[model samples]
Target: MPPIALFIALLLLATPLAQGETDSSRSQPVVSVDFENGVLSPDWKSEGSGNATLVPEGFGAKSLLVTLPDQGSRFVHIPLSAESVRGRRIALSAHVRGENVTRPREPWNGVKVMLKTVAPGGTDYQGLMDLYGTFNWKSCGLITTIPADVTEATLMLGIQDASGKAWFDDVSLLVLGKLRSRPASPPALLPPEKLDRRTDLPRLRGVMYGPQGREEDIRKLAEWGANLIRWQFYWYDGTFPEKRLDLALYDQWLEATMAEVDRMLPLCEQLGIRVLIDLHTPPGATESRQSAIFQKAEYQKKFLEVWEKLARHYKDKPAIWGYDLLNEPAEGSVAPGLLDWHSLADLTAHRVREIDPHRAIIVEPGPYGGWGNLPFFEPIAVPGIVYSIHMYDPLAFTHQGVLDGYPVGVEYPGMIRGVLWNKEKLREILAPVREFQKDYNVPIFVGEFSAIRWAPGDSAACYLRDCIEIFEEYGWDWAYHAFREWHGWNVEVGSVKDDTSPAPVPTTREKELRAGLSKNQSARAVNP
Candidate 1:
């Protein structure tokens, strides 16, 4: 199975209530600790080997000092009643400083404050931004929109894995009101320039092809009227949130991939299918949203080298669609000082352009490309490029049951937990991407979109149809998550939506996908 995307959030900022809106936040903060009197609050509890207590010195008058005598972990946190905070945008703010803190071995190992939600659905949705090494007092906070059904929320501050001393002061929780819809307008397109080549194709429609695919699959896709295929070079598949590939193996995998593509170019040309060479797993990618490539300078160097080699090799390949820079860049994980996803993408895109200026360049936003991340996405300023995203929204719905403890029996177009979700909800969630397209005057491409096969109530098929319809309505290009990649995602292998041991039979999932892709032959694209 491919690495599962780490679900993050979009914090809707508070705006003046337009006549009908009411504020749901409490007048007073839920918790505030000055520790001035040198007494820990009864509500605050300490867990793990180390301790959190009052110390003479802090960022201000007094602070809570967290110490780990051993090289283990420790934390101090307070649980909050969820009823009052549910369905609201909440911010966790604290003044923190590290003293002799060890450099982290894992991304989560550091001095930081974390917010955890105790909800029925088991997503690791939390406010966990790690800060390592020694530093002076600094103010840091996390903001997120909490779910309506969440039972409790916890705010924890301490050290994990590599233990050390840290100080926390002026801890407080602020509750903003519920999220509101951003007003929308019709999309505006930028006038064309010499470098603009977004119209290289009429539209993109197909699946992510990988090493698992047969050469003849190109023929099958063309027969079904698919014009594009995202050929993913995902060589590092052993771990779920994959680990860094060894440098020695990198050369080997790169060669093996080039050899395979060499064998498939003609068939692709003959079938009228364009190939999007996707470096599905790049350099030091990891399951953690904070991928190693973002944290390690060495990996960043390797990342550029991969693109340089690919652009040089495939620059002249007419059947190639574009180079998907990196599958999903690990955002917010650049260590203390390093390049960010945007910088890396800009650098790589320009480097590729120096060699080949005509092919469209595709780039995706990260912490993993959910619609939520789209709002924060900083578009690359370069031209002849398409912005990319991966859609599996209502994540608890589309990717149901795949992640352990995520809610089962989830059906689409109905209430899940306390939210009424349907096609309109999908539209609301995607408004950011739509606004992005309009604001930037650039084209959008969905690199991957799909759901699990075992989703109940034909939800998988329904979800697919809804996603495709939205893509068409917006005139965005797209490719399904997979074809012949894994049986779990393969619509062809499943006869029934709920059959645990699916047998070979035509399915609604496949039918909906076929119907959607079939339209590409008749219509050029909503925009094109």
Candidate 2:
């Protein structure tokens, strides 16, 4: 045995294992990235297609060469263990060079080394060193303390969305002595009154998914007694290069969209409707590249810049409720190790507050924004901000006959294709969000929830009313899924003369919704 290995073994023998502790430290050092045998390590795995090969001409005469095709992202990674370096500071380093690499100026897509670790119960954490665009030989590394509960770690390097060549050599992982004793996890920064603001503001109810030029529809929503509108507007419609975006076209789209918003806000103010300008993009849309936006440094900057511009424009508009950051992000959607929904929300919220301090911002937990994911979100600890969630529980029921695979005849308050679904089930489904509300004490927003028009009207009404009742029970602001997007989502419309266009008039469903929402408001008023 090497002297270092013998010494580590002796040290381990001297210390007794505590209860529930594993004998994890190995006699052999975990060398994850040595290309000494002219091959990538078998312990490493690949996520996408790329020409990954061992080259003799590396930093020390051997390296891993990755040639990414003009396609989606490619990743090479190796997994490690917390037991290998528990309670110690570890460093991961690699020498790298790139050629013919290209990507959009924003929405970072590039080669990077990511250290992802998971706590015992599966809380994902990450640290990173990224290299983007074309670059000469350079060293990238990350230093992080291995938390005691961490059970797993992964080191990754890859290029995303760009046709390029990259060289990684002299890769390493090393443990430096025991870190300072500390809490097993970062404590919640929950100070009483992060800053005091109005907590009893009248709960605003409305709908999501609308573009500008719906002035008449806005008026109709006001008539229905709704006061909030989560406006889903598209800032970029045209496709750009996957690896490189055309900023000039983005500028035009921004200018045109902002101008339309300028015109629409006044109409909303006149109609007594507050607006939450929703920066929405359907998943996989060019602008809502949930996969790439957080990783690219330029993209991160641009996202903040867009929010800042909106904040500056609506700084004084009390009717403009807040900025709903991204529509619904997903798990594993962000660039590895760079940023996650929580990090993005914290950054964007702080930036927007700096620009417009009083407006209440709404942030949602990702993995498609369902209530179950709420527990994963860390509190932003900012006052005057609300946590948002979308509800489509028993989607088998609410989405019956509309969404694909749901087919018809899936009923609520009864069996949904052999599975019983009722209001009780709904409450159980929402338990996580309820727990989050209790834990965080932040305001809640049911930003989107509804049954499709194809659903039985009476049953759908029962479901919708139940949702509103639950929201009110918790004092949460609520909104239907959409206003002027799809005829099926409109309670007032059984069908549309033009399904592609908005239904301009109220249908029977609208009357029921208006009545239900008004009842909710009345109950709140009586108790408020």
Candidate 3:
């Protein structure tokens, strides 16, 4: 996965509500906390060192000063009850100044101001802006429209990174009663004739990680005549609000995660692109804690709850193509006496059906959900569902310099580190997926497939073309591994040189790839 900070940044970006609307109930400030009285305000609670204190002279009169130590960081937060700001547009403003806020890498010492909303069942949403450099008192604020279900709102200000001194003054929050909608109902959705059938067209192509505010990236997919996008969201990031095992925190995480999807759905609908939401569990849960979904019964049930919530949230959105239950279920890593992919998928599929029987539900079979296991897979019997498989076969060529165990100079076509590889071998490797599609009489989706850009000359395009040919021949819908997040999986960047070039090239490599992928007769069918 790409760095966690990237995902956080993506999630934090939101389209601020316009300030044109006004409401009678929003005349007064709903919440205010400034240490003007020369004492730590009782309304705010400090976390970590809790170094917040009232300084005599500051931006205004007395300001809240947080002393930053050489190691770790500190924060102060005030939790607002739901009744106070529910169904409102909140505007939080503060005067903040930072000094000597330095760090070795990202997430360095900076003063961050955030406005967060929490819903009953899960995390609704939050947005934050950061100030890093030493400067005079500057006014910073954030405006957001709280979701309907929000039960709590939080205002947080803190210093991060190695060392920094931060001062906060005149912190205030005002709630503007809910923005009025135009009172138009959404279009009615008709049920499909058959169970477990594709509602959209047959040919599907695109990439993943369509980050918030990156509609142009998704538009790029549409410009290439692709029909679908398979974006992913993590079950939990490293932050306390998300990573904690508490059900409350998990609820918050779900709300916040789905809010991101809801924010992007409109753009997708406008661009004629469908979305498949992949619940990607982070490495902290899967690797460090050894608490993957299939490993424990409790975790499995919680995973089901996540799907239930997501299905309920997106049941009516036409742009939602499907719900990919889990990114890649690792059957090999499951503990003894735990649920297998077949049983677990069955459970989640049933639960999702309770809320939405028509929205497509996607399931992937084991051995890391790769193509090798698809032939042995038994389809889960559920309506509006499809079988998903990830293809990275002939790992030597596809992964090349990306995989740690693989040696450098592992090229495609012939002799991957002197192992003699070619398109025929690649075709043989993908035969199972093709054969499986023919045997099952069910829809197959290549959820992920890519060749690292380090492959020799046009090898990346060659590999992608071969994979697309098989997908087209099998009438399968597919998405490349990624769209704009990481450059390594980006074949659109044209040719990249890892051996000679220190850094990968920008996304200039899409012309040849676009030609190869768009060559499908289906492209004309969809584009024309």
Candidate 4:
């Protein structure tokens, strides 16, 4: 016979007691027999012809004695049906005694008992118990889990070498009661009815400096219908590690920045203004390099640790609207090659869920705020996650004459025609978002969208008006790129170097533009 077939036959012979049946009913009787009895048949020959017997000593009254062979050991098997031990956790116990037999070359000798379950056309699960040392008689025990899919189970008792001996008795296998399954979790509750219609429209808002500038400026924003404020948190001081990355500097900045946020929270709360805490880094690394940081295990650990701390700090503060994971994560521009935007967004959103389970998370897409690879807004496993797309398309027209030299020049007259009012353009531009909203059942928020001041023929105002219109039509939320800053040409200022500060007052042209845009609030009127 082949070795595999012999192994299978041995396993069957070892476990003779059938489950859910009496011992007398079995073809092979479970009896108290001696070594000279008819238990040793020609087919049931011992491997090494060693002395073995059914004795009446080791296990209180009666037991089976097994003596090891010199060359090697062989297993004893008894046939068992497949229907016996399926889907159960079985317990096995036996009284075993190891005899002391000194060998000329080997160190020790003993017997091993194995319990195995084999499923039809599947792998076998095996459990073993080894009897070692020089014990006259000791009770040994083992517990094994029978897989839910198992069809048959086998038990084997064997000894290795010719000199060593072992005794076994009072073996028992028992079936355990079935376990109850756990209940499923309840579904997430929807946002309250009071907050259902609480939509924010896009408006020119000032990005104030920290706590001191927060109150007065935020109140001004509320009056101007600028429902949101774009805020920043730095990762380091101006001079640290020669402007290189430093762990200490990063931690210190996080501590100080969060402190400032705490101070601004109540102020924003009182003013009824929402805050978008922008997590930004200097433009140094490329998207690929930055994305690598997220892929690293160590970096992910640190990132989550920081967010957990922040979430605990602002657990129930409604003034804080969302967390902008990163600003303009692009490839090859900062870190070289594109950052894995999709993976990074998914991981960041997951981490945020672990911390503040319920907070709107704002995520931006690719290089320099381009929406080329807008992420599909799947039902965020966590509630209140928003897809943020920054629209600065036709950059040449929007960033004209800026010192950094945006690609599109101010002379390029880009007009968004077809929409009745500039605001109506909001509906057309957000056509994708409308589809996404219906598909995923999640709200859309334009985190940042605007045109440059130098764009020709009042294009900036026209774009702004249309963008706001779109936001209101869908009852979506949005934030203007800036309130009054030289970062882009979107500000209602005449010149880049002009003193367009909040208190300095607006120019005549700025006044006329604001009035015309404000009156063209057709989108808001209809949606409201």
lDDT of each: 0.70, 0.62, 0.62, 0.48
User: Which candidate tops lDDT?
Assistant: 1
Candidate 4 contains a number of clashing pairs equal to 32
lDDT of 4 by residue, 80-175 (tens): 444455554344445567775323232222465545566542344332223444567544433334545666665655565434677766554544
Candidate 1, 1-528: lDDT as tens digits? 111111112233344445432232222355666656433346666678877666678755667777887787787777667764676555566677887778676555678677778666444445444576677876655444566578877777788876789888777666543344433664456432211345446667888888655766887788777888898888745543323547667777778988888788888888778889998777765532355666568888898998999999998998987899988665432444556666678899999988888788998865466555555455666777788888887677766766433556788878865667788988987887888777767778888898887778688899899999998888788999888776768877673445545456668898899998888776554434
Error of 4 at 106 (Å): 80
lDDT of 1 at 216: 68
lDDT of 2 by residue, 165-252 (tens): 8887766665532312222554354332231144334668777755665677877787777878887756444333342354455556
Candidate 2 clashing pairs? Answer: 106-299, 107-299, 108-296, 492-507
Quote the positional error of residue 94 for candidate 3 in Å. Answer: 53
- Ranked by lDDT, the better of candidates 2 and 4 is 2
Candidate 2 global Cα RMSD? 10.5
Ranking by lDDT: 1, 2, 3, 4
Task: Look at candidate 2 and tell me the lDDT of residue 449.
Answer: 91
The candidate scoring highest on TM-score is 1
Any runs in candidate 2 off by more than 4 Å, and if so which?
A: 1-200, 236-244, 282-289, 331-333, 401-404, 495-508, 519-528
Q: Once model 1 is optimally superposed onto the true structure by TM-score, how far is the C-alpha of residue 292 displaced, in angstroms?
A: 1.6
TM-score ranking of the models:
1, 2, 3, 4
TM-score of each: 0.70, 0.61, 0.58, 0.50
Candidate 3 residue runs with Cα over 4 Å from true position: 1-196, 211-213, 235-246, 282-284, 288-291, 332-337, 417-419, 492-509, 516-528
